[model samples]
Target chain A: MKKAIQYTTLLFTCAFALGACEKSELVDYNQPDMIYVFKDFDSDVKDSASYSFAIKDESLQYDTVFVPVRIMGTAKDFDREVKWAPVDSLTTAVAGTDYEILPAKVPAGAFSANIPVKVLRNTAMKTNEVRLMVEIRQSKDFAPGISDANGSSWYMPGASRRYLVKINDFLTKPNNWDSFLKFFFDTFSQVKYAFIIKVTGRSEFPSGSTGLPYAQFVYYETVCRNALAEYEAANGPLIDEFGNRVTF
Target chain B: MFTSIKYLCGITLAIAMAGCYKDEGNYDYNEINKIAITSDSTDVVVSQQDTLRINVNLSQTMPDASGLTYQWVLYPTGTAQTRRTLSETKNLSAFITEAPGSYVLDYFVTDKKTGVSFQKRFWINVVSAFGEGWMVLEEVNGATDIGLVTKGNKIYRNIYSATNKGAKLPAGANMIQIINYRSDQEIYIFSPNDMIQVNYIDFLKIKRFDEFFFTAPEPKPQGHYLLGGADKILYNNGQVFPVSLMTPPPFFYGLPLIGENPYYMEPYPIYSVLKGKFFYDRISQRFYRAGPYDIELSSCPAYNPALDAFDMNNIGKKMLYAEHNVTDQHIALFKNNNHDSLFIYVLDAGIDNAAIGKYDVTKVPGLLGADHYMMSKTLTYLYYSNGNKVYKLDILAQTSTLLYTFPAGAQVADMKLYLNYDDFEDPDNYRVMGIATNEGDQGKLYYFHIAGTGNFTGNTYREVFSGFGKLSSILFKSRS
Candidate 1:
């Protein structure tokens, strides 16, 4: 009975090992579920033309690398088209300029390799979350049917955060609401607000549960009206979807 | 065990390989620099003139050198001298003055590569002296039209022939220009043959307009001093005789050698004059002008001798008047009783209406602009008109009177008076005739006779010359 049990255990073990070692299309290495490091890059994209990353070296020198970046947020939701490419040769980059990316071999303790991916100007990334899928691979192995056997890695290319560019005391970025409120309050002076009140003549909407002060709400309404007036004075007024003047 | 080990090795190897990639980039380029000029040079020099040499140089800081050209110019000190280009190279040199005086020089330089230009100027004085005098002024004997000047100073017609041809007068000798009324020329001297034996005790002196030839104390070279008028004679006695009558006989005529187209009369009486150094008046303070210069002269009251004298209101501190001789078609000004001053009037029949005028006695000499003033249109003489009616005008009184009526179609377009001293028109003797331009303004000379009371006497007339172009200002020069 012991002999029969031993044989049976060996057979089962063999079956389990076979199942674990299944060669299904070379383990489908491409299906590693690409993790785009630049997924949130376009949230406050300052410049869509250039982006960079670091790499540990004494490694394979790649002629080119593929960085898959997707624009998320409203732009991606609508499937807006965007340009994607690897950074140009490093020799062409200016040293001190912030816009260019400088790549170097791992010097000492930390190994860093920057894989810069750029979006051409005409096809700039819109104001939205950009999901970048970047893979560092040897130029020779970059074929349609073959994947890099010994040279491929994923990385995020940017400051790894979002920021707003201040211009003329006004925030140039945060092309959305969340950061817009921060910029508005930070820049507005007391006298400027008072002047706004005198110019726009408007009160607040009735409060529901928020219990915000009526005067504060009134100020916001006036601010909106004044902003619209200033915009009209500069670039003309806005028209409704029906082609009629849009009154506040 | 072998299968598990192989699979583990494959997965681990893939992970290690994926993290191996390098970037080999080296960036370098050339630097950029630009060039520019910071300052321009002002140097120049003129020839022979003792003025210092002035040169023009450019002050610039440039990076690259390529197409650059320089130029210099010399202009006379006054605005009348148009600026001219002298050079196309950097040889900007000019003499400020041949001697001691002022001159203007301008320099310009241009960069061909960048198309940038620079310019500068300097006023320099050279060490040299001008000639002993500014210019020499002399009389052209026998030339009839000698533009006379005294030590380069333009002597106005203030003195006529007050003495003999070779005679010199005291520095401040008082004199008057004896204008011959007929030929429109001043009589520099009276011919000896034309002199007549008149009553020495009853010498005539011209004191006022109404009173001609008044009795005055005459002595000491009386012949050379008197403002004499000549008349041809007839042999009534054994010797030649002159008609004692105030009006000369047919042979005895008055010379009309003052001016052609009676000063301040004709197409229109337009007058203009310079009141100050730069002030110019073209119109008689009536028309509104939309131009660079808006000069208007206030027309004050006329000079009236009848009221015993002029009221203070009639006299302007800086004043001018347009006395129109409607019958003569000539315009003239009596500048502070200096009637023969260089303050002549010019009509504007061209662009800008610039009065072609020259100042009388200013240090800064140049021609100014002026116009004519039309007072009244009337025939001051009697008889000889298309309508056969003689017209007369009293300007100060502002009255137009008809002296005589004439037949139809004898249109008297122009009534011109002539001073016929020698009466070149008459063969036997001299006769001062009234030249009239009639019917379409055609000119004709007539033997005009008006009574002492401004009445018509000899209306019967004859026509002389024709086809004259409105007879512009005529300057008559006779055989002295």
Candidate 2:
């Protein structure tokens, strides 16, 4: 009788202990509202972006560049101003002359917004590139969020608080000149590229998904070839900057 | 300890016994009705715009036919298998609007009660009504229209205007060509400053001048040629634009063929089986060739003076006509810049050792003054027309034979040999020469049977077609 009572007590204890264990739930934290520059999830770079006016038309005097920013909290019913300014110490461009920071706001019920920076085409950009470093500032509605230096393993950060852009008007060989343009334009040379620009009346030759159809490149090839032939016939062989004969 | 272990074992046994206890739940089961579908024919052949009717005989194990829904669907057999619903009735009676090709027809019967569907499949071959014939391009009432001469010699005049809602093509339309590449059977009408692509089967206008290119060039269409159904070359204003039709539609012509040196190619393109495509550069007075898969044009390599009859790099004459003759030999007629001297240069179409022979035909009677020229694909003979007379010049013998003369008032407008690149075994292929004449607005066409020796069989026309308006060109529309 005594052993039966002891076993009954032990069985009850095991049942009670097993029933007390429960799955853990995550609790939301009450934190301050904050914002940061959103980074492309697939990109390895954390804080920089570059643009060249050489790929744009010569007639374009000013162009707007957008930087994406995301909030760390829930969206609100009312719009919120996103505070951002150029870091003077790291910036090589003059604010009023080289670029202008437009007003930016995250609209109501939206978690993200684009900070527009209108970059101007200055004559000095033709020979040298201009750099601008921007950072988020504390505002009335929100505070600066997680940054690369403050990020933890559980919450990795990107260019969350700061970003940089390099702008230039100097001509450089396009990224797709060999894979796509070479079939039509043969080889890339500064002289040939300049001649192509003059004959086609365009400066940009975009590649990748947004690239022009192959047929258009073929037209440029023919036009450039004919123009080069005429130019040579009137003058002599077209000599490039490297003292090489230019041919299509 | 022994007592506690015994009590725990008893509890565990009680729990295991509870898991073995079973409960009876209320449920039901039933068998589904089996359906069987049958048709008289599983293989069908129909033409475009024709009705396709098929009676389906379906039976169910349980007599609940009223609850069954029917659907018929048709889709092409090519890579783009876009299914189109044909009918919802038990019997299919739908008109096929698909292009000429193979297709699949499916009959689906679904039972509402069981939510089950039974299907029957069929294979369909769709043909075009205007599949094969001769298309005659003519200038009627100051505008261009097309006429069709069926294999049975049935004439359908003003077919283009009738099919296109009375919209007429521009005047001075000089060429009508059919490009039957892969699944594309397109007809193009070429005028001086305009060009239009029409449906090969219905002659309905499909595209206009600016639609043929991504960036439309000057509208000076010289000619359009196909290189063995692989590449299409379009010549406009002395520029050559080539596009590969080996892929699917939405094809646009790319830029002209560029070389290390500048060149202006004549309209004639000679495609050799082994040597890709050849073009005569009018500016440099030389020959340039693009390989089978090449986009750029390259000049022919230097040749030996003793072996080669003429230098391909420096012909120094204007190309009047260039086309492929018998076997691999291509015959080109050249005239001096002054238009006084005429010569015939015969060469193999291949790149190496291209020159075979050259002949001075400036002294041949009525040869230099000929307006139209066509080379025999089976023999070494050149057929040309001067005034109302058509002469057959024997290229081997260097002699000219007067074949036939039209009426005194008749003027030869155009001449073409009945050649079908798609159907070489066609009954009239290379055996009949069609000549169009204009005798004071009363246009007439004649078909002369060619003899084995490259002459007219009876020195006369075998068939004569009239009621045409000043024909400019005629081409055989072949069906694949």
Candidate 3:
């Protein structure tokens, strides 16, 4: 029993010594070298700056469209700088000719900033399509985030680091035109024109002569469209005072 | 002597050595002694789908970061504290699921090296999305629709139509009441010709209640409660045919309904079991006490011996407007007698002339009995309407004071107070009321807040919404 006791005590002493040595030699590594930017873009709705829409010639006055930018893991004390520029060869919309680009920088401790771009109007580009694509470049203060598509975060990052800007006079076709919007738009147009012609007794609608505001466009495209649909469903398809059926 | 001492010391040292093992070297004696859960509130009330953030403040911890295990266990509150792991992080939050009612969240931590553990429990109340709000019943073009107004002033219309298999609530529902019974919430919808009950938790499933629950049959009952109906009284001990008042005391569940043409004016008041389980039966211009006699003391006021019976002939035959609070055992009202008389009947007073008084509402002269009215949740005030004018009546003082009078032609259709009794984190502040009224051709809800006194005058209100139908009855569902 004495021999066994001595052996156990000796083993315990050696184990304790080894544990103390191991803990004393532990090292510290708690620094992060990179940060991330998160975006929450739900494919279901293009309501915000999801894709691209235009100010068009119908808007007599110039308008500015603001794009949102966000970054994660921002330092509390120092401000971070990010560089953005339009790819010259691929860009069709001129800077001073079409739209003006505003200052873009993220303040200290904030995860979000807005990039404002001024869009101009020209009657000649009413029917033709034009786009301005801006690409993001990394800087010393920040980089493209480690997690590009963060499902957990609010803002979803688009493919690569690209933003598309457009300016046009006519209604920019919605993305889901073929699947859902086509039928509603067609029906709404027919009823709308008929109602307009009957009310004003004119060949062309006055609002159409200029252009519809983006907000008015959405309202007429959805809310008013549904209301008119309900009316037509209760009654039959709309026709003019002279017994002429209306079509877009 | 030296030899004997040497042998004893050797045996002692060997025993001590034998007690120590290699396991002691691997185990860390240091561990967390105490732990506390800190948040905006310990007893928290959250709406469905809301996020709850919890931060754990630890008194001590193991030296190695990887040598500890954290767990957040959630379960319903009670003896059956079945464990459900919500998370394993040190300090973070969890998005509340759609489950409603009281819950217990326990933060458990175990030291991997020492096998020592610490745990603490947090009480979290998850209420339905319909928390702290008034459920308005609107009569649109003769059809019944229900609206919800939250304490935050958010309003929803025709919730019954939207929630229930697209089927509308009982059309032209005259009254809406939320009753708490047997560990569940039942919302009763009353129409003049029909009646139905639905579960407030689901807001979709209609309960197949006992046929007797339908108080308003073809003839219309003068009084209703858990035990009595149109002209009958039932016993709590058994489900048998009811008897008359002339029968034995045990059989007399309620007073007999009389009068050739009695109109059951008071809507059935939803109450907790501790308060007035019995209801008031008004027949032949007389009020009779009806319901179970047994109730807890804290809920009921000290019984006043003078309130056995009272003659309400001066007030009127039908109720112009009436609301009863079971917890306080009082029914505040505007008598259908149409004499501008407002009265408060304290059930504690058990005598023939037990009415507190007959107060005149002359201060608000032009006001009518009521177009739509409601009793404040505290049972302290009775809000009634004349046409466009609304007045607040102090039950104790028996005085009616003018609170608001809408535009000359605009008529107030309905009124309700939003009360939050289930929330423990927030102090009781009954500052908001929803009003449905018509100004011209349009009917809409002009929900407003009574800031300083909640007296209706100079209170801020927004014409927040308009609707397709006329407003009928608005009720704030209480979470008991």
In model 2, what lDDT does residue B240 have? 83
lDDT of 3 at B437: 77
Model 2 misses residue B218 by how many Å? 5.7
Better of 1 and 2 by lDDT: 2
Question: lDDT of candidate 1?
Answer: 0.30
How high is the DockQ of candidate 1? 0.00
Residues B1-480 of candidate 3: C-alpha lDDT, one tens digit per residue: 444545655665576567575564666574353443455556777777778778767666335455668888778877744656778988647888837868888887777766777777788889877755777777666677777766676776777777786777665566676544434565767665445666685467464223533221242322234322212332221111123222122222222222123333244342333322333334444443322222111112333446423343333344444455434345534454666544454443333333444444444444344666676765567777878888776766656677776788888877776565455344434566777777776666766666555475355464466653666666667665
What TM-score does each of the candidates earn? Answer: 0.17, 0.66, 0.45
Best by TM-score: 2
Evaluate every candidate with DockQ and list the scores. Answer: 0.00, 0.20, 0.00
Ranking by lDDT: 2, 3, 1
Q: Which ten residues in a row have the lowest lDDT in candidate 1 chain B?
A: B129-138
Question: All candidates' lDDT scores?
Answer: 0.30, 0.82, 0.53
Q: Give residue B131's lDDT in candidate 2 (0 to 100).
A: 70
Per-residue lDDT, model 1, residue A110, is 23
Model 1 chain A scores worst on lDDT over the 10 consecutive residues at A162-171
lDDT at position B84, candidate 3: 68
Top lDDT prediction, candidate number: 2
For residues B149-232, what per-residue lDDT tens digits would candidate 1 score against the true structure?
A: 122232222122221243322222211123443432222221212222211111122122111111111211102211113321
Question: Candidate 1 docking category?
Answer: incorrect
Q: lDDT tens digits, residues A172-223, model 3?
A: 4444433333442453343454353343333221122233222222223333
